[model samples]
Target: MSAYAEITYEVEDRIATVTLNRPEARNGYTIRMADELGDAMDRADRDEDVRVVILTGNGKDFSVGADLTQGGFDFDPETGPDAAWQEPAGRCSKRIFTMNKPVIAALRGAAVGGGVTITLSCDYRLASTDSRFGFVFVRRGIYPEGASAWFLPRLVGMGTALDWMISGRVFGAEEAKTAGLVHSVHEPEEVLGKARELAREIAATTSPVSVAVTRQLLYRMASAESPFPVHELDSRLIGGLGSSPDAVEGVVSFLQKRPPEFSMRVDTDQPAYLPWLNK
Candidate 1:
């Protein structure tokens, strides 16, 4: 409920919606926005009342990358010793990657540079018909950030990732869909509604702990050396969930032909073998 200068956070129907509020600036990415975003994500992850998250921007554009008015301290090598050499966008992206709840990005208008890379960590991206994505770092004489080097290739493919980032060209939502970057594109007015509908569906039907465990398993095992590790994880998770209360409800509801009333909470009821690799 706290006010954020660069973003707005609201929770309704178990879905936490984080809106980038700099409409006049086209939601220009800024250090303050990044910090606020990190805080918002942490709030969502820790709130048991929240089951899903939707991230989007205000006004015509999702984001136009960072604000150019701030000078080049972001790219300047001589800024300071305490600058930490970390891209601000990485902090927000990492938060999204580690979230227990599903994240859906509703992108409209232009999503260029950091705009595109930041959304890469989201579980799903739904864009507007007028949306355009650009990895314009190359054109700006910089390199890609937000850990896109790893996520981009995995989401699309090495070939598509290279073609997009290396070229630094702007592409439409349809091309983004063809490249596997976006799930669906809608009219500008309907994009947010579509994202919310998906979030509501997930929040209304899925088991929180199961969804959390599944997210971690896929993300962790994708780069795994072999399928054996995944198999092992699968067995462990199945063993833990088979007798859980949620599993019992899941089966009973199915046999009775009714909606499930899953009671497990992600904050406290996640499996004992969470972060499965660490186990």
Candidate 2:
């Protein structure tokens, strides 16, 4: 929002594209890049006109990990939340995690260390056939950032997560798909195009408020230990649909064989009764 130097944010046709802008260094990870990315995601989430977000890097490789040439990460344990301190990658990934809008990550070439970790919270990941991914923290003598340890296990299972994190080795697109890390694989030239196509489809058909609710439910409720709480929440949501204009529009449009015109906005129409909002 405040003149981003490390990333670019653009919104068109209801899709916000946030691209990593450091092409000269293969979009290397940096503190400034992390802050810019977090700001971009927050901007997209709050904009009613933006229904979907597509995240991709500018050049051939998504990112070659950190820019060691500029000297690696330096952190101070004494830095507090009020101070100018936040873990680099989590600032971006955590912002994406809280977003009501769906996010799709488009990857090509290498996505290693901080690169792949930052995208772990995205709802979907579409990578090029030549794309390679890694959690190379151990090899680099630094531990993982971005809360990837939590996200990675949920995505690829404990076994695969352990294998990748402990070994610190890179894997290709096919293996990423097989492990459920990436949703789909595409040609390098077609990956971003495919992401845009998917974003358009989501923006055109789905109810914004419904997608927002569903996104939160999947990320929060699905991980709960008890199904009773989910059932209670689901019943409440279903009951509220009777009073929802968008719900009526959905059914009427279907009967008329036309595109649904949902009037509910994600920013204002999301139900305030949600129990997880405070936490």
Candidate 3:
């Protein structure tokens, strides 16, 4: 087990659980924490032992957003072509978006500001009944970063996105589910367990190559404005995996009435790019 003060990672049955460990601060993300998270995800992506990644927080909250007191609120626009204002959050956002394995967010408390942005990057989100969500950048007189400006509108509609981003209103779990921010809501105690179960199910059935390719295509379709070249990318992905061993196993298993044994291997050496980062 590799150790981290702000985050923890563990692998079992090809499922990797990456937990936000700053409970005393309600799991807020400091700049250091953001860096640690990116590193952890990178480790998971490179490790063949990890086929799925589950992200959750320790203690009572998922994340209260950036730690303002720890200078998480500090941002400057004049740092040059690559400004500091964009570096930290942008790096973290890219990490989540480009993660090859499926990433699930387990929310048990407030997910605000950057916290909400992190949740938005997840492939699926399961929130506890007591969880609350808010896009609080406007309240602090700052614009939403971490691709929330683009991601939120796509998840919900533009109107609802505007309402949340501009108004900075707090919404409960049901509202979040209604707005498509979360896939399901469970009891507070069940949040992590349910996330683990979902991860296990996905791990049991999904081929590593198929999951990575599908995740790449979905991210492209959602964040890319011009869909012109995406078709080519999709065709390339499908053509490459059409005759893979896992794909053959999947088909044969169905005909033979047996569970498929998928190979959890990714041939790609680099993580895919996230379009949201360009904006």
lDDT of 2 by residue, 1-279 (tens): 579998999999999999998999999999778878988888998899999999999999998877866644556436635556667888888889989999999999999988999899999999999999999999978898899989999999999999999999999999999999999999999999999999999999999999989988988886888999999999999989988999999999999999999999877787899976746
Stretches of candidate 1 exceeding 4 Å from the true structure = 71-85, 276-279
Among all windows of 10 consecutive residues in model 2, the one with the lowest summed lDDT is: 71-80
Compared with the true structure, the alpha-carbon lDDT of candidate 3 equals 0.81
Per-model lDDT: 0.89, 0.91, 0.81
- State the TM-score for model 1: 0.95
Best candidate (score: lDDT): 2
Candidate 1 lDDT, tens digit per residue, 1-279?
377999999999999999999998889999888889999999999999999999999899999998867563456556564646677888889889898999999999999988888889899999999999998888989889999899999999999999998998899999999889999989999999999999999988888988998898888789889899889878887877666999999999999999899999887787666664233
How many clashes in each candidate? Answer: 0, 0, 0
lDDT for model 2 comes to 0.91
Stretches of candidate 3 exceeding 4 Å from the true structure = 72-87, 223-230, 237-242, 268-279
TM-score of each: 0.95, 0.95, 0.88
Cα misplacement distance, residue 13 of candidate 3 (Å): 1.7
Query: Candidate 1 — worst ten consecutive residues by lDDT sum?
Result: 72-81
